[model samples]
Target: MSQPVVVVENLVKVYQKNIRAVDNISFYVYPGEIFGLIGPNGAGKTTTLRIIATVLQPTQGRVLVYGYDVAKDAAKVRRIISYLPEDAGAYKYLTGLEFLELVAKLYTKDPKKIEEFIEIGIKLSGLGDRLNDKVKTYSKGMLRRLLVAKTLMVKPKVAILDEPTSGLDVVNAVHVRESIKRFAKDVGGTVILSSHNMLEVEYLCDRVAIIHKGRILVVGKPRELMERFEASNLEEVFVKLVWGA
Candidate 1:
């Protein structure tokens, strides 16, 4: 098998010196895999992703992205990864095109590369002429699609997304989910995302880790987890594990 694209070893995080937001959790994600971190609100999912993205320092253990330690090689990690926070927002005053262009410029100074990335962003967005309109006018779903497009446009080696489909109607949510899966397959890049939606995770993730109360409850292929738990789907498995239903 190929080397893992991401590895988390005994990762931990603490807040206010006493509250442990993440506790000694470990997992590995492979290249081109859509790995899901599924949990309820305040389950430490966001904290884990933040640590891996180099936005937060781990209180213990380590995270390696392609063998570069997140803590010691943050600049290299940041260069290869794109992160989308749970409540990510674009500049309201900037047009969708302008926002994408700005992000592209930050990653590359080559004019050809910038234009190439912008074009990729536009294609991924599927916004057509609306790409010219200011982002403040976009609906919640449209804004999310735009964000997703921008996140993947640069073709980062890894994408860490916290709740990529948080608040959207079914159609938009499905579109965004498909876009994520397609991006991973087409670009051969790894994707790690956290989501509370079990159905979405079941549909999109190649493997999933169930987290609760700052620890990983289980990790496996969704179908394998369901079979092992004698459940019909991920939702049932989640309920059985978390609630003992």
Candidate 2:
């Protein structure tokens, strides 16, 4: 097996010196795998993803991306990772194509490379002619597709996505989920995403960690967890572990 692409070691994040948003927890993500962080709201899922993305520092412990410490090698880490936060908004004034172009420029200065990335973005987004339309006119689902395209277009080594399919109709949600899986497999990249959708997580993830109250209750293949708990599905296992139902 390949070495892990991302590693979190005994991570802890505290706010106001009293609220422990993330308790001491740890996990690893490997290349070409979709690892899901499954939890309810206020479960510290967003905080964990933010720390891995280097947007926030851990109060204790450390995160490493491709063996580079997130805190000490943040710039290097940033270059190799892409992050999509929940409720991420696009530039209302920019056309979808233009928005993609702007992101491409930030990662590279070469005109040819930028064009290549734009092309890739267009294919990934599947927005067709809508690429020329202003982002402000796009529906929520369309916007999410565009954002996913932007995140994966550069083919980063790791993609940290928070609720990548949140707030979408069933059709759009399925499209976005498939896109994430396809992109990671095609590029051999690692993906770590947080999702409250149990079925979505079970379908998309190679492995998952069930988190609650800022701590991980279990981590394993979804099928394995179900079998171990003698539950028929992930949702039931989750309820049993987190709520003792």
Candidate 3:
């Protein structure tokens, strides 16, 4: 494989009283690929993502974003990464357009692209009529669509989305998945997503890492993994692999 855009080597993270939330796990994500970190709740998915996003420091081992050490070169890492956490807070008082404009300002002085982004997003998200309204009034699906737009507009080298489609209805979730695929292809960037949705991972990710108890149980293409375990789907494989069923 090509040099990994994201690399983790023996990564470990501990919480209060040194409880190892992430325990000596390692993985690599190549460019232009959709990689999923699949796991149950409290399985360390978010913690691991936070560390890779440079929001949290690893207690042991190392994480690198395109060879920039996350610890020593976080500012550079942040420049090339757009991270959307599971419950990312929004400025509820700002209009959707205003919110995106603020995000654009963080990366560039030109608001022209922000305008373009708003136009494209409002159309794709079917939120044009609501774009002028405060984000506080947006529904869950609407919020999801807006955040997807925000992440795409940044044009980062890697887009890390934690549970990007957590609360959307089926149609909205499908739309979000398509948008994610397009965003990665457009920039030739790596997309790493963490989700418990097996069907979503099977359909969206090029490959997945199954995490349990803060450790990786398996990593492979969804089909390959299912076949290896003599299963019919990712969910079945997950049960067999994690539950010894």
- Candidate No. with top lDDT: 1
How far off is residue 138 in model 2, in Å? 0.8
- How well does candidate 2 score on lDDT at residue 157? 90
Candidate 2 weakest lDDT stretch, 10 residues = 236-245
Please, what is the whole-model Cα lDDT of each candidate in the order they appear?
0.94, 0.93, 0.88
> Ranking by TM-score, best first?
1, 2, 3
lDDT digits (tens) for residues 75-143 of candidate 2:
999999999999799999999999999999999999998998898899889999999999999999999
**Pairs with steric clashes in candidate 2:** none
What C-alpha lDDT, on a 0 to 100 scale, does residue 171 get in candidate 2? 84
Q: What is the lDDT of residue 114 in candidate 1?
A: 99
Model 3, total clashes: 0
Give Cα distance to truth, residue 212, candidate 3, Å: 0.3
* Residue 91 shift from truth in candidate 1, angstroms: 0.5
In candidate 1, which residue ranges exceed 4 Å CA deviation?
A: none
lDDT per residue as tens, model 1, 26-120: 99999899999998888899999999999999999989999999999999999999999999999999999999999999999999999999998
Give the TM-score of each candidate: 0.98, 0.97, 0.95
